[model samples]
Target chain A: MKFGIGMFGDSGYDTKTNRFRDPEKRLKEIVEEVIQADTLGIDLFAMGEHHREDYVVSSPETMLAALSTVTKNIILSSGVNVISSADPVKLFQDYAMIDLLSGQRAEIMAGRGSFIESFPLFGQNLNDYNELFAEKLNLLLRLNKEEKINWKGTFRAPLKDQTIFPRPKREIPVWIAVGGTPTSVLRAAQLGLPIMFAIIGGNPRQFLPLVDYYKEQYALAGHAKDKMEIGVHAHTYIGDSRQAVLKAYYPAYSFQMNRIGKERGWSGSFTQSQFEAGMSMQGALYMGSAEEVTEKLINTIELFGLTRYIAHI
Target chain B: MKFGIGMFGDSGYDTKTNRFRDPEKRLKEIVEEVIQADTLGIDLFAMGEHHREDYVVSSPETMLAALSTVTKNIILSSGVNVISSADPVKLFQDYAMIDLLSGQRAEIMAGRGSFIESFPLFGQNLNDYNELFAEKLNLLLRLNKEEKINWKGTFRAPLKDQTIFPRPKREIPVWIAVGGTPTSVLRAAQLGLPIMFAIIGGNPRQFLPLVDYYKEQYALAGHAKDKMEIGVHAHTYIGDSRQAVLKAYYPAYSFQMNRIGKERGWSGSFTQSQFEAGMSMQGALYMGSAEEVTEKLINTIELFGLTRYIAHI
Candidate 1:
């Protein structure tokens, strides 16, 4: 099993005011953290892409490229590459370039990014969300496997015998980042792509059934059972004590959760009990000392038979 | 005056020959070199975006984000963002995000990238090349200054009061990259934008007149003299000995120059005299000991009265 840390490059927000530090300074600290992780034997370090002010990484590929120069041995991946909002060809080219810099250590997880800001900002329609992902995903998959792709899609222009440059030495590994969508899960399984289950909240046991469903679908699609690997994405922090972890992480996590909840029509406040419940329950928040995290991770892996675990630290 | 270094992240044809280290390992060394430069008081570090297999950094922003986390105080900038091949909205969002990560120290140089692969790969037309850059440049400018933009163009769909998120704390610095095109120079001056001169080969004195032309155009465009900064982008290296610098750089340099020459109807096989001319003549290549580079830079600055000297080391 592989363990990786994912950061949105969030510098953490001041809870009372919901404000962030100077982004430049915060980002510098984030890069330092990645270097520290690499030295600590962390297997992978991933950054998420966000177009909102609270999240600092809008160009994950570029950030990865810069990181390539600084760190060694750690696999570099993206928590999400907002596929529905970006050009698939450019994404392919960008990742390929990163692969070259990082020596084929580049990987990406594609999804419809968590926010709606990308739609209007990129002149994309939210109504065609499903079709957009579908068409773009097909194109992205084609670009990933073939050097010369002849593709036509409704969301973008058509390509006739187009070959992207800086092709990876080998096939670049790709995973689908799905946030609780059965249809998306089925789609990933049907395509025989690895699944990264983004379990931000709720019990981890609940996701076991989804994992089972994915395996069944993969089997139905005639893919080998041994070919699939299920992974979990969780929010985490490791400190000397649980109190230290909570004190350092909860305010920012609550603020961000509430901000997202306000947009998605969920309850906004993070009650003390609810926070404790989330920490204690078999859910995705992997916070505490390193020992506690390792134990919980092992348990979760056993429960879901997950081969990989990614934490948004 | 600032000293920086640029490298084609990929080793290209030398991959099988053991002439260059693998991309990942080489990048780790490069990052260490940049850190060393930072400590040595180098002012800026820029990475170019290239789609060809030989040149590796297709996603400069991703790499920068990773660098933002590790380094301190040095200015982080992209050598070039291919505005012609990339979506302006996405480009703006990515850079703005970089600003957030880098504490508002992020800047970008926009250009119609040197390579042609991006054209067909991204489904853009070579016929509308000028129009693509013009519109994209205009859009990029607007997106940089304003939070909400309502724009329509032939290259992209119409936006109705669209706002790009993750806005920078201040107006993100932008420069137009030019490769000796009078129209490009005029366009940048007309827009009150700074110019990044790509001085690949030839005498630096030849570009002095073009610098004068830009200042003249800026005055004609009704902009203040203090508003424009001319940055020279050149291939560079610093070593303990002049002989050592040549020994390490010449083979890779010749390899790249020959490849480019092949497509442009130039002859194969780079000669030692040509390399010597570029190094000794006041041209683009900045190769030699640190003292040699610093002296040349000061001389160039005094002669040109330039604001920034971006060395492509």
Candidate 2:
């Protein structure tokens, strides 16, 4: 089983000041963190994409490209590149170069994005959200599989016998990142692509039906069972003991939760009771001592038949 | 004065085999070459973009992003980003992140491109060439100066109160690269933007008039005189001895010149006599022994009042 770490390059919250950290400092910290992850023998480092002040990275591929030179033995990937609002041609070219630069350790995870800011930013229409993802993913897959492409699509201009340069030494892995959407999972399974479910909140057991659906659909689609890859991403923190970890992590964690929650119109502030429930074995938040966290990870891995697990810190 | 090295990640040509070298190897060499440049105290490294098999880098920013981690003290830039066919918003965001990553060492040199391949690949029409560059450059300048933008253009999507994230530590320098186009030179001067003249062939003295024109227009536009930055990019090779350098560089140089000449439908192949003329003190090619190259560079820098010189290899 592969274990990985993921981050959105979150700008640190200085609880005393109640202000966001400088993005440049946060970006440098991210680079150091990933280098440390590589030193610690982490299998993967997935960088998240966010085009907001709270996050330092707008282009995960760009950040990954920076890390490609400094890190070794870590598979660099986008936790989720909002591909629906991106040009797949450009995306393919960027990641292909990253693959070559990193000696073949680059992967792309496509998603519709958990936020809608990119839609207007890139001139993409919100009404065409599903269609945009479907069409762009189609184009991206073709760009990967074919040396020359002749494709037409509604969202972007058509490619006429075009080929992107700086081709990767090997086929870069492309994963589908979904936020517990059955239709999204079904699409990934049907396409025989690896699926990464982002389980940020609620009960971990609730996703069991979606995981089973993906496996059933994947098998029905005649993909090799041994080659099937399923992964989970969840908010996680680990320390020598649960109390010490909670003491350090909760202020910043709760601040971010409430900040994003306020934007999303969540009715109640995150409470210690809810946080304790989330830390429980049945909940999605993976936080505790090393042994406790490991046990929880193993349980989730076995329950979902996952090939990979990513701690979204 | 700033002196820099620029490359298109040109895949080496094997004369005996009459074949191109591997791009993966060339890319690694590029990283090494830039690191060495930084170590040697080169002020800048400008990567070129090409959407062809002969050139490995199609996204100079991607290559620059990769180099940001490995090299320190070298300004990372696109020799010419072919910005006419690019999205200025994305370009600004990428360079902003690159600037933050490299401690304010990121720059963008915008050009209409010497080749037409990117236009077709990016779904842009040749007919809209001038308009595209004009519109994109305008938007790019606004993105650099403003916290939020409300922009509309004929070529790309309009921006409405949009602000790109991960803002640079300082305003990223944007230079205009012109290939002896009087109109292009005028636009750069009027905008008070730095100008990089690409002098690939013919007599260097011939550009004196264009350089003077830029200075006159720039001063007329009420820009600060000392702030005016003018640069020249030319093919350059430096060696210990003139004969040894000729023997080593001539075969490959003539081969590339003829190859590109053929593609452009030039009348005759590149001859050694022409190469000899190009190597003269009056010529544009900055090749010869160290003393000879220094003399030629001094002459050019003095003649054009250049602030920066980029040796394009």
Candidate 3:
């Protein structure tokens, strides 16, 4: 099984200043972090996009390109590229260049982002959210496969025999990232693409039905069963002891959860009970000592028949 | 005076296969070259954008981002980001991230690119070329200065109280690159922006009048004289001896010139006499022994009182 690490590059909260830490310092730390991960033989590193003061990176591809020259062996990917609000032509070309720079170690994980800031920021309308993703994803897939393309789409300017340059040595890997959406799962299955489920809260086993559905639909769609790949991404933190990790991770974790929950109008603050429950064997949060986390990971891997597991730290 | 080097990252012609050299090899070589330049204490390195098979880099910012981590001291910049067809918001954010990554060493040299490939590739109309550059430049400058912006333009969606994130540590230097266009020079002067003249062809002294015009206009516009900056970018090659350089560089140089000449419908083949003239003191080409090129560079710098000179090799 493939194991990977993921980061949103959040600017750390500094209680002394009562504000976010400097993004530059955080970005430098991320470079060092990835280099260390590569040295430790991590399988992949996925960076997520966030256009905000709290996050250091808005362009995952840029961060990936920066790491391409410094690291070896680890796959560089966007955790979710927010393709709905992105220009696919530009996105494909950028990643294509990264692929060449990294010796074919680049992948793209496409998702309708969990955040809405990118919509108006990139001049995309919220009303066309679903349609925008579907259309742009179609364009992105076509750009990967075709040399010269003649295409028409509602959201973007029409292409009349256009070709993107610096083609990849091989077709770059494209994975679908879903958040408990069956239609999204059906789409990936129908297209025979690998799927990554974001199981950030609640019991990890709850996603088994969706995983089973994906497998059934994938087989019914005439895709090879052995070729199907399934993966899960969850909030994770590890330390020498459960108490030590909790002491180090809980304050920041709860603060972030409450901050986002407040933004989304979710009821109540994040409590110790919720955190404790999430740290359990069936829980989604992959936290605790190395031995405990390893056992949980093995169980989850077997439960989902996962080909990949990403610890979102 | 500040000195810099520039490259278009041309995939060299392979005489044996009669094909372009592999771009992957060229890209890796570029990273090594920049590292060497940085080690040698070059003031800056500028990478140009090209959307074609012969050039390896289509995104200059990507290349700059890659170099930012590996190199120290050398300023990383887009030699001439084709900003006319580019999204200014995206451009600013990308460079802002690069600036933070490099401790404020990132810069942008904006230009309406010499080639037209990006126009159609990015779905921009050639008729709106000049206007597009004007509008985008205005937006880019504002993004550098303002924390909150409200802007409306013909080519892009209006920004309503928008604030781009991951702000730069300082106003990232913005320079205008002109191909001997008086109005373009006047605009840069009027805006109090540094201007870079691309003196790639003809006698180098021929640009004296235009340089004088810029100095006059810059003063007339009431910008600080001491703060004024002017730079020149020229086609350059340096070697141990003229004969050694000629023997090695002539075939490939003539091939590229003839190939582009064919595309632009320019008459006649590139001849040896023309190459010899270009290598002379009066020529724009900076090809010769290190002493000869240094003397020529000093002369050109004094002739225009250049604050900076970029050898586009």
Among incorrect, acceptable, medium and high, the docking class of model 1 is: acceptable
CAPRI band of model 2? high
Each candidate's interface RMSD: 3.1, 0.8, 0.9
Q: Would you estimate the TM-scores of all the predictions?
A: 0.83, 0.99, 0.98
Every candidate's DockQ is: 0.44, 0.84, 0.74
Model 2 global lDDT (CA atoms, 0 to 1): 0.92
Which runs of model 3 end up more than 4 angstroms from their true locations?
none
The TM-score that candidate 1 achieves is 0.83
The top-ranked prediction according to DockQ is 2
Q: Cα lDDT of all candidates, in order?
A: 0.78, 0.92, 0.91
Q: lDDT: which is higher, 1 or 3?
A: 3
Scored against the true structure, residue A221 in model 1 reaches a CA lDDT of 95
lDDT of 2 by residue, A152-265 (tens): 999888999898887887778999999988889999999999999999888999999999999999999999999899999999999788897779887778888899999999
Model 3, residue pairs in steric clash: none
lDDT tens readout by residue for model 1, B110-142: 888777777776778899888999999888888
Candidate 1's C-alpha runs over 4 A off are A7-18, A39-42, A66-70, A160-163, A201-203, A235-256, A267-300, B3-22, B25-33, B69-74, B100-105, B200-209, B234-258, B266-303, B310-313
* Candidates by lDDT, descending order: 2, 3, 1
**True contacts reproduced, candidate 1:** 0.67
DockQ of 2: 0.84
Expressed as tens digits, the lDDT of each residue in B153-212 for candidate 3 is: 998888888887778878999999999889999999999999999998899999999899
